[model samples]
Target: MLFLNELLDELQSGDYFLLYVLVSAIAISVIFAIIGTIVSMNKLVFIAGGVSHASFGGVGIGFLLAYHFGWKNFIDYSGPIYSALVFAMFVATVIYFLTRHQKRYSDAVIGAMWALGMAIGVICIERVPGLKISIESYLFGSILYVNSLDTIILCILAVILSILFFVFYKTILSMSYDEEFASIRGIPVNLLYFITLQFISIAIVLSINFIGIILVIALLTMAPYIMERFLHSMKQIVMGAIVLNLIFCICGLAIAYQFDMNTGPCIVVFAAIIFFISISAQKVLKKA
Candidate 1:
């Protein structure tokens, strides 16, 4: 309690940048919670991973084109963010079509794609002469570097995701449990799958700044998975996960601020500890 009070006091006295960071974190956490719940229940966590890393290819493409065309306003124009969105959506669609038939080699194909994206990004980045892109930020995350633009993007996404969930909650829940049954009931299984993947891609791209590509999967999966142990209904799981995500983000931000550490790792570490405890408690209950 004392710690939280101190943190709040500091934020009250801090600059506008700190306030921006807090807002961004909350918005991103909300999006992640809902999207993560969908990804978890639909059993598409692996696809989320593919989309997250595949966004780097888009980043690389943005830089390659901007540098080659002498576009000096890449930073001001959000060139990289657009490229990532497009690239992530494309990859998500491709993965969906390729793996829809449940081929033995589907996982292999996604793995290849995962590697190809990183490889392409590295090559493109290396080809850009005098380019000084922050590869570390993309891979490891840099929440402190999130600007107003990023926050706006995340806020819009959160609104859109919330509406989608509310409008199609029944269909989405049915699909998550049984695609075959959903199709039998005339639900457009393929379309819902595609839309889900699209949302997953967007969430992953936006999350790069807060959790980075490497750790974004963990952030998206672990919280909901923890909530799942105590909740049977999908709605309950999502609501619980959102609360847990906010807690992790706030606590992590406070710790990072106090120690001058990276916010992404701090958040993930806090989540990891909770996940461990949840599993341990479940085991103990089972034994009893």
Candidate 2:
């Protein structure tokens, strides 16, 4: 383990941002691991994708308000972030209602919403007079943009989410695999679903900066699913996912930095490699 003084020395060095990267990765891993487990358990991976892209609408709205309407303070003062949260929650709610009884059509509906949000974001961004950042930053993760503020926000969200997971541990576990049974046990199944999906929305919005919307689903589902093949309990699955995500993010960032590559896609490629390897392991272990 890194000693405190040594850690402090490293933080003060020229590569201080490395600390930011490490913290951001760990915090995001914690949030994604827990959320991913719930998402995979409930089989809402596609909906999660919809929610992730839906956040782009909020991001565009945020930039428009800040640059077009003089809400610059509002944008960074949790404006765009909160707007994305609201937009994502709205999309998640819509998906829930639309698919509640129309299971056969959920995919089509979610795809429509997904495209709609990205379109809105693109159009809104086009109106910003002097936008400095590229849309790809939001689309494919921007390593150069990782800073102290983003790291702090991620840390705060991670703590809040961890607390929530603890408080609703059993309820979530029960609902994950069997919502009907959870409802039979008097757990407000619908309410929990709405609330959890909302949480997932905010997570995606915040995580956009680190991993981008394009790869959010993989971080939020692939690791959890891979762990499921070996782990039997939710806690173990989440823990294993945290470790797996850390590996993907850290290794991806290192490789990206060394090769001048896009951070988001690099991270996802590592995940894809691991996912395939896990498939092989699953087959081999099954025969064992």
Candidate 3:
């Protein structure tokens, strides 16, 4: 009763923004988790990793251009962030199309792009002076400071992506399982693959502000992989990943609030714990 009263008081006092932030974080997590699962199921985790890393270059380029032009009025800092997302997606699509023929060397291509992106970001950041924000936050994530605008954008993207995923569920699953078969069956394999790549890019960018680029891949891939070990269907896997994501988001945010820890790393730590627990449970069940 006392706890309820305090909660009510917090809600009445606008402390509910914390709850909003928590929900938004979970939603963002869910989006990445779904994208990660999609890519992983299609045997494209490395490609996704490459795209995520390459996005740093996009960020650097965006920042460099905006900073040099003194384009604060025209391009908000976050605008470059979106532009970087577009650039990264474009690069991913090109890489995907180029490597579609030389399937064996896909990883090598991804690795080269990843390194180049990082180098570009480094040079861009070094050239800039008196930039108040830490680029590291974008690389790793700083979830606790998420504003309402970020939350809104995340929610909107998640909804749109979810709808698209649902409508094209069969095409996506078909492409994942056997692209050649999908193509033979007239599934528009190339178009579907391109769409998936673009969506993955957007998902990665959306996640950057929450988990940082370094750990974002883990949050995206790990939750779905762990869930897939137990869940049979793709639907179950996605749902389980979303639930697990929500659990981590809430627990991480609460702990961060209570202890004054950084939000992004804290959420990843919580997710790691959950992964361990799930693994242990699976082992115990197998033994029993």
Candidate 4:
């Protein structure tokens, strides 16, 4: 009852920042669940990781361009996310073309891209004159600081990703299981693969705001993988991932509020704990 009353007080106060945080959390959960399911099905965890880091190069470039164009306030306007989105898309495309037929070398190429992208970012940041950028925010994330624009963008992305997956569910499934069979069925395999990469790129870039690039892959992989251990169907796995992610985000946020801890790491740490618990449960069940 006391907790409910304090919650009611916070609600009655009409905190717009709190509202934004809620919306961002909800939208991001939806996005992460869908993308996590897809990426896990496709087994493209490395691709997601590569794109997440490669997008950092875009952040550095965006910062440089924004400053040169006399838009010092651009960074606060979510310029880095957009810039990274473009770069991520490009990186995704490059990875697809180069690795489509070279399964043996894909990992090596991806590693190179990942390292080069961050190196480029480091150089760009160094070239900026009198610029005070906190790499930690970009490295870790600052979900509490998301503004109205970001919340709106996340809502739109959540809708877009949901609609795309719903309408093309079988097509995505077919491609994920057997690309040659999907192509034989006239499912536009190449186009779908390209499209998947783009969506993955978008998911990675947008999530950088909440989970940060370093831990973003965990958000894309952990929930889906956990669900796959117990769930059978794709839809079930997606729904389960969404619920689990929501639980993590909400509980993590509450703990962060109560303890004045960093929201991003709190959420991540909570998810990690749950992940290990799930693993232990699975092992026990298997032994039985």
- Which number leads on lDDT? 2
Across 1-288, the per-residue lDDT of candidate 2 in tens digits comes to 232343467777755776887899999999999899999999888899988987898888888978867876674434566677788989999988998778899899999999999899889888888776677778788766778888998999899988988898999999988889999999999888888888888789888877887888887888999999998999899889999999999888777777778888989999999999999989998999
Candidate 3, after superposition: displacement of residue 4 in Å? 11
**Model 3 misplaced regions, further than 4 Å:** 1-11, 15-20, 73-77
Question: Could you give the C-alpha RMSD of every candidate to the true structure, in order shown?
Answer: 2.2, 3.1, 2.6, 2.0
Task: For residues 1-288, write the lDDT of model 1, one tens digit per residue.
Answer: 434666467678874566667787778778988999989887888888888888888888888888889888884225676788899899988898889887677788788778888888888888888765577777877765687788888889988888888899999899989999999999999998888888899888877877787888988999899989988988888888888998888888888777877778888999899999999999999999
lDDT score for residue 75 of model 4: 58
Question: Each candidate: what lDDT?
Answer: 0.83, 0.85, 0.78, 0.83
- Candidate of highest TM-score: 4
Return the TM-score for each candidate structure. Answer: 0.93, 0.90, 0.91, 0.94
Clashing pairs in 3: 139-212, 139-213, 140-211, 140-212, 141-212
Clashing pairs in 1: none
Q: Write the residue-wise lDDT of candidate 4 on 10-124 in tens digits.
A: 6889756666777788888899999889899888999989998988998888888887888877755377778888988999999999998888999998998899889888888
Q: What ranking emerges by TM-score with the best candidate at the front?
A: 4, 1, 3, 2
Clashes of 2: 0
Clashes of each: 0, 0, 5, 0
Candidate 2 stretches with Cα past 4 Å from truth are 1-10, 72-79, 101-104
* lDDT at 79, model 3: 63
